[model samples]
Target: MSAIIDFTTAGQNFQAYRAEPTGVVRGAVLVIHEIWGLTGHIKDVADRFAAAGYLAVAPDLMGLAGLDATLLAELGADRNDPVKGAAAQPRIREATAPLRSPESAARIRDGVKEVFNHLEATAEGAGRTAVVGYCFGGTYSFALAVDEPRLAGAVPFYGHANFTAKELAGINCPILAFYGEDDTALTDGLPALIVSMQAAGVDFKYTVFSGAGHAFFNDGNTQTYRAEPARIAWTETLEFLEKHVQ
Candidate 1:
């Protein structure tokens, strides 16, 4: 039902977890991962999308963070340990520092576009396509739209915005962003971002789950997962996708 496949972007090889839908494909989606590369959680997200009747692919964008393939895999695997996962947080952040740099962002942008190409060329894609991501992936989902206006929609869950106003203005697709009220580190800047998105006349809508915090939808991370909010978020996401991409 799902498998890992390799694709090249920026002259570097990377692997992605791809899932095909059970019935007629309504659309294709590019699922981006959190800070932890192409971890199991992200693969699960792709599979969930597939279950909803869409071809989904989650790319290992950690490659743009300068992590070697082997080490990236090890780090992704280590995220399963309750202790090691906690201890690995700092290093994970360090490794992802490169993602904020222009060069890395450009590479990641090019890489995701190539993934879209692969999906359309081989995955029996629909005319409409969307991008959805969590945390780190969510940030990129927003950023991707800044440059890739071909997307049908963009959904970013609990990700901080880092794109410029000029870039945001370039996005033509509607954005349905999610956040948790308690995620200070991520939500603190939301007010300013809302102003910018409005000023740019971008079609952006955001919802902040009252009791949920960062990574609330991440069922694998018990410390952060909130079932009720996650379920609500999932339902909302599905409705959004159906309206925009299906």
Candidate 2:
């Protein structure tokens, strides 16, 4: 079962979804949402993790503003069609801008802390904890890894790549990153980033799924969905978490 909780961060109340196994949990997972916010897909992902015997929590980063699952899905849909994709960029920017703000950053930090608080407060959640994110959530997952030293692992899928060698050096856990070979914009700087992480002694694993462009894991996007690659990525993610968090 799942429920929502109000967490105070940066003086704002951020809503977060929590899911756990029927009985005791093996560990805890913080499931970050996509650019569209905490939609059904994100919730479903959390449920999947819960079913796998982990306590899963998905925080609504865009909760300050109101957005429904359908709208989030539409916003997250393929933007390859210049007309549709280009138009969606501004909307995405608007939706995501708050997260980058100073106030929003503090809120996100506190919000994530609240998740850990919830986990540490529970018997199942106290064992170990990890994080996994998609798209914007993927980027945030990296940030969470840097900010929270207690995390066991992080898996970021097709998210933004923005980390300096110095910042990467501070990460205390392993990271498994998934990217799309065809995503030129996001993948362009990945090689350098990986090199820097390696130089900084950060244990990082990266995979670029061939022929899969951005947002391949998003089942709502029929046009860009690569079922095989997504399935493989999911399998790898589960394995990575089990290996590290367990």
Candidate 3:
């Protein structure tokens, strides 16, 4: 079962959706949402992870203080409409702006720390733990792994890399990073980043899917959905988690 819970972190109350496995959990995973925040898609991802025999929890890292329902509604509504989707950019930016700031990132780190604390208190949290995210969430996943050493693994699907080689050195766990070959910004720096990670002795697996663009894993986005690559990515992700967490 999954429920919404509120916890205090960095002087603010953050909301999170936690999904527990049917019986004893093999491990715990912190699911992070995209730039749009903790929408239905993110919740669905959490539910999927729960079904996979893990205690999956997705925290509303956007502070959960002033979420505009109208904006959120538009975000979910425009998934299939490119014309309407363009209009949603500004709102999404506005929603995620707080997280872009260094101060806000620190707060989010604190929030994630609280989440880990709660998970550690659970029966299923004994073995291993991981963090996974999509798009913006992917970026946070990397940040969380760097900030929190307890994480057993980190997976970021098409997320922007915010940490440098120096910062990534702090990540003790393995990372499975997926990106799109067509993602301009990521494509440019990905090679060097991979090299740097290898040089720094960071255990990592990186894959770039051809003919797919950003947000390719999101089945909700008709324009960006590439069924084959998405499926492959999902399969690889599950396999990686099973090896590390279970």
Give candidate 3 misplaced runs (Cα > 4 Å).
64-73
Per-candidate Cα lDDT values, in order, are 0.84, 0.80, 0.81
The TM-score-based order of candidates, best leading, equals 3, 1, 2
lDDT of 3 by residue, 103-123 (tens): 766676677778877876776
lDDT of 1 by residue, 1-246 (tens): 998899898678888898989878879889998776777788898999999988999998777658665665676556657768887777766665677688887888788888877766754554578899998889888877887777889899987777787888898999999999999987899999999999999999999999899889988777788999899888988999899887
Better candidate number, 1 or 2, judged by lDDT:
1
TM-score of each: 0.90, 0.88, 0.91
Q: Name the top TM-score candidate.
A: 3
Per-residue CA lDDT of candidate 2, range 75-126, in tens? 7664545568878888767655566766665566567777766776776666
Global lDDT of model 1:
0.84
List where candidate 1 sits over 4 angstroms from the true fold.
Answer: 68-89
Pairs of colliding residues, candidate 3: none
Provide the RMSD of all predictions against the true structure, rounded to 1 decimal: 2.3, 2.8, 2.1
Clashing pairs in 2: 79-85
TM-score (C-alpha, index-matched) for candidate 1: 0.90
User: Using lDDT as the measure, which candidate wins?
Assistant: 1
